[model samples]
Target: MSCFENIAVEDIQSCINAEVPSGISEVNMNYAVHADIATFPVPLAIGAVGYTYAKANVIEEDIAFTAGKGFGKIKVQVNTGELTFDGVGSVGNMKQKSSLSFFIPSNDAQLLGFIRTRLNTPMVFAVPERQGQNRLLGDKFNPAYISEVKGTTGKTGEDDKGVQFTVSSFAIPLIYNGVIQEPAIIP
Candidate 1:
């Protein structure tokens, strides 16, 4: 059996929520937040065959990507110096240090809650078929699923240690929260 079977959807949702830091401000001007459940450590193994013992330990980092127009101008305060904007853009290549937040609706929240309730249950991360310009499909083509549970498991004890999990690519999807009074326009 695979270790993924031990994980529930709710566990993944909790990991997503836990990934979001506290005291952060949600995008309330003209944007919304949408989250999807992600699977890591593909082709997982629970020790050996016929054993209740499973290693479900994982680490998830906060994922914050830029959205909307003028997202590059978003400012974030850091100690004595404040990080300001040098340009206006989305989650692509831009130089700005802003801590923006996204919100979820009650229905999505309920769904996430339900997913969380299924942690430690037998589960498997599905690998979808790839056939387009979409990077997600390309990722699905790769069978390696790096778990974020450890920051140093795959790295050598050196100064050049790298991250274990694959970095999520950026996508510009329109988010709707029914909270924005108007759309944010960049000039």
Candidate 2:
């Protein structure tokens, strides 16, 4: 005999009208991956890795909206906050200040390899955005170097699995050229 109760239909896909917003798919996060070694405290190898700013995780993005109480108050716009994105990475490799115990800093292969060497080290602070959506979200802010280093030995829980690395860096806006990255809203 089957030892089971009634089977409920799961993973359902429904269609909505144009006015209604579609369900969320997945959020894409972007981190600073650079080719240089000067960004760090110690001398990283020729293959420094770019730290993953976030995981398939949660970021505490706080935004408040207010209206202007004047004679010509018509709409509500973002009057405060220059837009921010902060959270923990599953790896916990990036910190606000410089660290001495991290493995990547000591190991040349780890330092100058993979994510570290491939990430774009910006000159200033900014959020990543797609090339097409820059109009509404503003111009390409370029993921510049805005205090995206320095980290501590955080927990190893990991994102989408457990919890661990907490972000020491500040959140920046995402200005992509085509695809939308993490810490952003396309809908």
Best by TM-score: 2
**How many steric clashes does model 2 contain?**
33
lDDT of 1 at 83: 12
Which ranges in model 1 have alpha carbons more than 4 Å from their true place? 1-107, 132-187
Predictions in order: lDDT: 0.24, 0.25
Candidate 1 C-alpha error for residue 154, in Å: 30
Best by lDDT: 2
| lDDT string, candidate 1, 43-136, tens digits | 2234434333222221122223234322112121221111111333565655322222212222334434433542222211111111111011
Cα displacement (Å) at residue 73, model 1: 36
| Residue 187 accuracy (lDDT) in model 2 | 14
For residue 174, give model 2's deviation from the true position in Å. 5.6
Name model 2 segments beyond 4 Å from true: 1-27, 31-120, 123-143, 154-177, 180-187
Q: Write the per-residue lDDT of candidate 2 for residues 135-166, one digit (tens) a residue.
A: 11111222234233333344464512211111
lDDT of 2 at 79: 22
